[model samples]
Target: MKFFIKLCIVGLYSIPFAYLSVQTDYEADSKTNYIIMSLIIGVLSYFCGLIRADLPLIFGNIISFSVSYFCNSIAMLDKKRADFFTPINSVEQIVLITVMSIVIQVIFYKLARRFAKGYINIIESNNIEKEKRV
Candidate 1:
């Protein structure tokens, strides 16, 4: 339940960036691609709670990067290849990609830190209570 709320909030937060990634004429496809990316990030991050707090932002981004990059590299969706902020040359493309990656990391970290803190605490406390009874 809490994870659902967090996922919804993260989805809403990512929408603007998704819209911004559409550099080509296929506006709908581009938006869908990024929305999918956001979902991948959110779901993976939510599961990361089993491990540690920041693991979602850390490991989730690392794992999701390849999938997102593969989706970006193909010409089928956005020709821009995940480049944000209107980067022109290859160097600019690299720079913008890096920038977008950093932005995503920050956003994911912020959302998880805010929404996940209480939920993990609740779970831990409940587990502690159950252990006391046993």
Candidate 2:
């Protein structure tokens, strides 16, 4: 439940950036890309909790870069546009992607903490009930 909520929050946070990425390119539909990217980021962040340090950054960057590069390449090929090379455009693209990644991390961390607490409570209660039964 906590993870699901966190996933929802992270997924929601990513939507704007994904939409902006697609809108700036104006070739393919941004909404579809937004949903796909949000899901990818959310799922990755959720699983990232299971790993140790440095992995999240590496995984996030790899996923973000791959998606950005792929979308930019597709836009270039399909629309014959050169908007991605501009300094401001490049900055915006990086900023949005980075923001999306960070938001996912924050949401995941909060959710994981809440989940741990809930699990502890359940365990304690189970132990108490077992003691009473015995």
Candidate 3:
């Protein structure tokens, strides 16, 4: 099916994003930077999804990247929660981060898909209005 093919493509495309997401070097030191980086990842992934006509892919990328960023930000900002997070330099921590990121992506996909649909509807409506006036 077309959906399966698109899924495969998105999976392939996500390899680099996933790899980059785990790098401690990319970690944000402040909450502001974390938000900014997440947005950057989301925008880039959204375009990839648009190109593929795949909402799941968009959500997957956005959720995975944002969750990873969030976890890191929490570790950096909160003393209490900091102890719960695995240190970035450890292999166990890297695995945990990767697993959590994927789990969040799967769990939140439906909600993200709904939001994407609403966004698409707004864009379609705007285009329809423009066409009617032309």
User: Which candidate wins on TM-score?
Assistant: 2
RMSD to the true structure for each prediction, in A, is 8.4, 7.4, 9.5
Q: Which should have the higher lDDT, number 1 or number 2?
A: 2
Over 4 Å off, model 1: 1-32, 53-87, 124-134
- Evaluated at residue 73, the lDDT of candidate 1 is 49
User: How much lDDT does candidate 1 score?
Assistant: 0.48
Clashing residue pairs found in predicted model 3: none
How do the residues 1-134 of candidate 3 rate in per-residue lDDT, one tens digit apiece?
87776675456444434334444334543345333444544554444444445565665555555554555554555554444434544235545545654455444444556667788999999999999999
lDDT of 2: 0.56
| Local distance difference test, each candidate | 0.48, 0.56, 0.51
The list of candidate 3 runs beyond 4 A from truth reads 1-8, 11-14, 24-88, 112-134
Which model is ahead, 1 or 2, in terms of TM-score? 2
Could you tell me how far off, in angstroms, the CA of residue 5 lies in candidate 2 after the best superposition?
A: 22
The numbered model that scores best in lDDT is 2
Predicted candidate 2 versus true structure: per-residue lDDT over 1-134, tens digit per residue: 65554444444443444435555545563446656666666655555453322343454455556565555555555433555346555445656766776787668756765676687899999999999999
* Candidate 1, 1-134: lDDT as tens digits: 76665454444333333223433324444446555644654554544443344533444344334443444445434445434334353334434544575566556656666667877899899999999999
Model 1, residue 70: what's the lDDT? 44
